[model samples]
Target: MNGLSRLPRLYVDPTLVPTAQKGAPCLLTPEQARYLGTVLRKKVGEQVRVFHAGMGEWLASIAEIRKDRGGLVLERPLRAPQPCPPLPLAFALLKRDATDLVLRMGTELGVSEFLPLVTERTNTHRINPERLHAIAVEAAEQCERLDIPTIAQVQTLPALLGNWPHQTSLFAAIERLDKRENTLHLPTRQVQEGDGLLIGPEGGLSDNECQTLLKRPFVVPVSLGSLVLRADTAVVAGLALLGNGLRSAPVSSQ
Candidate 1:
């Protein structure tokens, strides 16, 4: 078989909770068993690629297949674990579907972390971290990324700003660019590691909130364009621009 036609890739726990090793049978969870047996219909000798968030990716072979039970014998390592760039996105909480879209697309775009914030104009503070986490995992699996972005708990804008790290740079998306004298223009420098992007609620940040954010030396107000954009649209556009910038910047040792 050609190299491209090899086994399917899957994410699994690396600890081998059931105890898996080279030449040893590694038990597959019931969900995994159904996926391989019923969904993929793989035979006993079929190859599979498995990876863990903590451990690296591996090449394994199907040892057995059954409706309720299945196993894959570990073979060799495929790739080593790599660290994701520290590009964190802090967005004000939106409605359910929009919020999910941000997490899904952000993961695909290589965002390292997600911070759900509650702003002055935010409509809701209720967020399900578990659901968002699942979305991130699915996105990473589809995008073939070795690491999943960390999803943080929902925090108020003030609380988020209060504990903001010292070294990280913050880019705040604002609506009224005409008001600010020092607005960040596009094609500005590339975003390095430890940089953050912040998007406001649907109606945008309040006057008082904007003032508060502007007072911080670390925060930089950024404009999307002349036309108004929806909260979700702004996220995709902003990440695309920032992702491109990150790709252009020279790799840093730190």
Candidate 2:
């Protein structure tokens, strides 16, 4: 995985590639192969982009093919793609349709990871990891992205904020600082470049959750708009805004 930055290209793997890297043979998983062969219709010697987490993105070329299994030749390196903009989205689970929509959008939006928070008022925290991974993989392939974002098991709201990572925390509270201007440049106002966000459940956050957030120095509460946003809408809207924040900031120094 440490070599990820040097290998952001497409690959064909017979066995699962635990980590993709320069000069490494990234075997496509059966699911990945099915998509490349049946859905994508890619053949041998076809060029593709592949990546491993934290290694950033890279490009690869197919060398051979055997049904839906094959080998890949790591080609010249692509310009170092930035480590996925340090944006993490934590939101409560929505109903079935809405939850699936959020999963799809979160991948496309480049969310680093998802923590499905179970709040006291959460209607259901039901989620299938396999199905969610399918959604994320399909979204990445369709979006022409090099990497697959991670999805963690659903966690309780209290447990999520209790031991916050030592970084900036942006709670996309439905009733906090309003407007895009508030979200813009918030990273500068808070901790550092790494920004994590949390959106409320459909019914919105309970008084205890909001108060718990307010007391944290790392947590800077912000709003998406004046009108109430559905759980899915808030996730997309917040990601779009936060993504823009990462794009506008000056490139980080290593």
Candidate 3:
């Protein structure tokens, strides 16, 4: 059997304060306890794979199981803490189901961070951070990801653009293209640590908004083929291309 397939995976809250040594007792949060004891029916002595966003995955054994609380004893380290490739995705906020899909699939696709943007064409400005966090956690657990993607608070597109970092590369998926030659080519060079991909809202960015984005030196307009893709679909396709490129390129030591 594959090594990761051997044990069930669980994402523990780093705020719970787990020590990084064998025989240390790691207390579970109420929710985590309920999940292990009730949902999974985990019993004392059963082994589990546990991980935190700050700390990498570890092998742990169930030490205590109670109605409202549970504990795990850290046994050994599974994977060390390594930085996720800097593939931050800035996407215009979508409707409930569509937003949920992006959170789940994006986490599985290994996006390091997620930025929810309120664009000119966006329908809703509000996003449920708690719900999105839960979705990312569940996706990470199922996909065997070492860490969950950080979900930023909802911000306006203009604000996001204003504060955009200089070192990070940005690729925007544009819907309008007069010629095939106008499509921005995927980076043939090595991807740096903090490259980002941006996708507009479902109805697409307003003319003024598109013009504003195009004026930015860091923003490169890319096309996701000739057809117009839904907001969620564009996220998956864009991240898929970026992820492949990042994985293929050799990491720079500088």
- Candidate topping TM-score: 3
Task: List pairs with backbone clashes in candidate 1.
Answer: none
Which regions in candidate 2 have their CA more than 4 angstroms from the true location?
1-25, 40-42, 54-68, 79-81, 176-191, 250-254
Runs of candidate 3 with Cα error greater than 4 angstroms are 1-6, 179-190
Give the Cα RMSD of candidate 3: 2.5
lDDT of 1 by residue, 55-163 (tens): 5667889898899788888887677777577889999999999999999989988889899999988999988887898888778877778888999988998888898
- Residue 98, model 1: Cα distance from true site in angstroms: 1.3
Q: So what's the TM-score on candidate 2?
A: 0.75
For candidate 1, what is the lDDT? 0.81
User: Model 1, which residues run further than 4 Å from truth?
Assistant: 1-6, 17-26, 181-190, 252-254
**TM-scores, each model vs. reference:** 0.87, 0.75, 0.91
Best lDDT goes to which candidate?
3
Candidate 2 Cα lDDT to native: 0.69
Model 3, poorest ten-residue lDDT window? 180-189
